[model samples]
Target: MRIIISPAKKMIVDTDSFPPEGLPAFLPRTERLLSALRSMSPAALQALWKCNDAIAALNVERLAAMDLSRSLTPAILSYEGIQYRYMAPTVFEQSQLDYIRTHLRILSGFYGLLRPFDGVTPYRLEMQAKLAVDGCRDLYAFWGGTLAEALAAETNLVVNLASKEYSKAVEPHLPASVRFLTCTFGEEKGGKILEKGTACKMARGQMVRWMAEHGIDRAEDLRNFDGLGYAFSPAHSTESNFVFLKGDT
Candidate 1:
């Protein structure tokens, strides 16, 4: 399982050949909605950045507990080369990873309302795609507001993804300064899996167990694995949040 992380979408980990389907499906919609946002527009992505930064700030203590798990869990990645299986070497890099992880978590939370967190399942992918479309729409509208309102609106709106009455629930919560935009990417283009085999049959928990069986405990070990690569953040949400805040501030 070769995993490659690139700064290009904030540590996007490519497991086989492409991002999960929901993300790709959602990408073009988001792009079309947010067409006003130029490529890699800092202003456009800032709300997302602030939300992640806030979460990392809350994750500090939770992060400490995770190092212990790394020692106990040797099947996921080989922790032998890394000082702590769950941690990045420098605080800086850790923050980068955390920022990405935190936002992904928020995204997951949203989809959780409608689907399970199945990495490649059709339903999960579809829900993720919907979120990608909806989220970018809201985020782009945020820039017209004061920075604080924009950040708050982005966070709360994203949180709403999991809401049962997202449309009604979010409208009251959103700052009036922000408005939804329309964006699209890829036009629901199909994707290819360059990897030789599939990990689609494996549930996320099963995949983790498989990794543990191999005594793989660090992020780097996936480089030699034959299937997919996953980017992980410790389960401790609070600690992840602390890391987010420390880095973004």
Candidate 2:
């Protein structure tokens, strides 16, 4: 089973924690993207990124000085979003690290798919961004079925812990032979399930850590996850969807 998660927008360089195992699988395609990004002016990039001037300028500098290879941080440690912060990979035991190294895959707009320890530099592209590359209209079109094909090749089961924007790249293209199970972290309202953004992100991170520590390898075992105050809700769950409601477990 491969547990797929989204890459964080906020990133940092931390070469001390761990050295990258290798470069991204899609590095050649990444270089093509790098070329596209480097061609844009700061103002155009700022609009493409939908960020403040400060963020735009910082990324402009990042784009100008970016190096795809050499002196890179591991993909897991590089992301600094709430999800990554909650995962707390820095203190993981060797066995737990090994589990993630094998089971977890990070979805990226720039790099396509990334192993946990894959070498990566900070990038600002988002899956939903409108920046067109080559003849493709957006990142989704550019990636096409490549991500899905790679995941399907690795394992016949994929547990999606990613948001819709990122998951869209793979979900539509996954072959019928590969079973895609999505774990939903939400609350049971008046007979309805509602997913809150920040709370769900925290739950997703915590669940990944919990899964690694426990050596969970089956898609069915995901329903047994009781992390971050979430209880598995059988009533709201289907074979392809595991719903975990935040409250009493």
Candidate 3:
């Protein structure tokens, strides 16, 4: 089984804690992206990032000095966001780390698809960003079927924990033989399932930790997940889409 999640916008470079396994599989494609980004002025970059002055300035500097080969951090440790914070990889045991290395994947705008231990530099780009590259108008177009092909090479079962934006880069192109399952976390609100952004992020992270802790390898076994007050809801779930609903704690 393989699980895919989105990379966080916020990041920190820490190579000391865990040694990076190797470069990202899509390094060549990443270079093509960096080449386009590097050519943009700070103002243009600011527009592309769509951030305030300070954040844009930081990334402008980051892009200017970005080196794909050196000063890299593990992809898992590099990301710092709500989902990643809830996942809490910093305190994970070695066995859990091993499990993650084998099963977990982080989808990125720059790197395409990244293994947990894949070496990466700090950069800011979202899969939905409209930055045109080559003739492609968006990241999804630029990535094409590459990400899905990579996952298909690994396993037949893919549990998608990634959000719609990043997951679009892979889901549409997956081979017909691949069994793609999307996990949904939400609450029954006014008789309808409502997915709150923060709640879903926390749930996704917690679910990943639960899988690692239990060494879960089968998609069906994911129904056993019970983290952060969530419980698998057969009423709202299907074989292709697993739904976990949270009630009042």
Q: What is the TM-score of each predicted model, taking all chains together?
A: 0.20, 0.98, 0.98
Candidate 2 versus the native: TM-score? 0.98
lDDT of candidate 2 over 1-249, digit per residue (tens): 999999999999988887999999999999999999999888899999999988898899999999999779999999998888788899899999999999999999999999999999988999999979999999999999999999999999999999999999999999999999999999988888899999989999999999988899987778788877898988888988998997735
The pairs that clash in candidate 2 are none
TM-score of 1: 0.20
Worst 10 residues of 3 by lDDT: 240-249
List, residue by residue over 75-112, the lDDT tens digit for candidate 3: 99999989999999999999999999999999999999
Clashing pairs in 3: none
Alpha-carbon lDDT, every model: 0.25, 0.92, 0.93
Q: Which stretches of candidate 3 lie over 4 Å from their true place?
A: none
Error of 3 at 139 (Å): 0.8
Worst lDDT run of 10 residues, candidate 2, spans 240-249
Candidates 2 and 3 compared by TM-score, better number: 2
lDDT of 1: 0.25
